[model samples]
Target: MLRSTGSSALNFGEAQGANTDKDYINKASISLKEFKESRVNLKILSKVDYGNASRRVELLDELEQLIRIIATIIKNKK
Candidate 1:
């Protein structure tokens, strides 16, 4: 999900025009939604002892960072 959003932003950077910006913003927004959903699911899994607690914490932290980064990109594009 992070890679997809990053790729969309990178492609926008390589292109020239307003349309690219809108496209990137749209794609990144969708990716952001999915990332958020994943975060929710991760939280649920953690409650059930689906993985190492430490590792789950690490992943949740990383996912939050990615979400913020993608949100920043979308904001700046607008």
Candidate 2:
């Protein structure tokens, strides 16, 4: 999950400087999906009593916020 998240983040960085709105939206979409996946994985781990539940919750909150922001950008791009 971490690897996926990191990869998505790198992609997002490239997307941030995209020359076209469509390209930015496309890349941001991928990054957002990856973030959501990470968030869900965090939830599953927490439910299974894996890593620090508190830390997972914190990360979840951050991911949710990021997802919202990215979604807004995609929406506005359209």
Candidate 3:
């Protein structure tokens, strides 16, 4: 999940350097998908792997916020 999550940002950064609309759209779409998956995996991981619910919730909140920010950027991109 972390790999995908980070790769999404990395790919998107590359897309920003793309020379064509098609390339930008393709990379942005993949980034959006990866971000969503990462958000979901974080939820599952926090529940199934955490020994401390409070810490898990905190981390979940942070990851969710970051995901939302990324999603919003993807959505707003022209």
lDDT of each: 0.71, 0.86, 0.74
How close is each model in CA RMSD to the real structure? 4.6, 1.0, 2.6
Model 2 RMSD to the real structure? 1.0
Steric clashes per prediction: 0, 0, 0
Candidate 3 residue lDDT tens string, 45-72 = 7768746778767767876776676567
Q: 40, model 2: CA deviation in Å?
A: 1.6
**What lDDT does candidate 1 reach at residue 35?**
74
Best by TM-score: 2
lDDT of 3 at 62: 72
What lDDT score goes with residue 69 in model 2? 89
Span of ten consecutive residues with least summed lDDT in model 3: 69-78
Query: Higher TM-score: candidate 1 or 2?
Result: 2
Candidate 1 lDDT by residue in tens digits, 13-62: 44334357777677667767767777877788798989689988998898
- Model 2, 1-78: lDDT tens digits are 797689679879988999998899899899888888888888888888898878888888988898898889889999
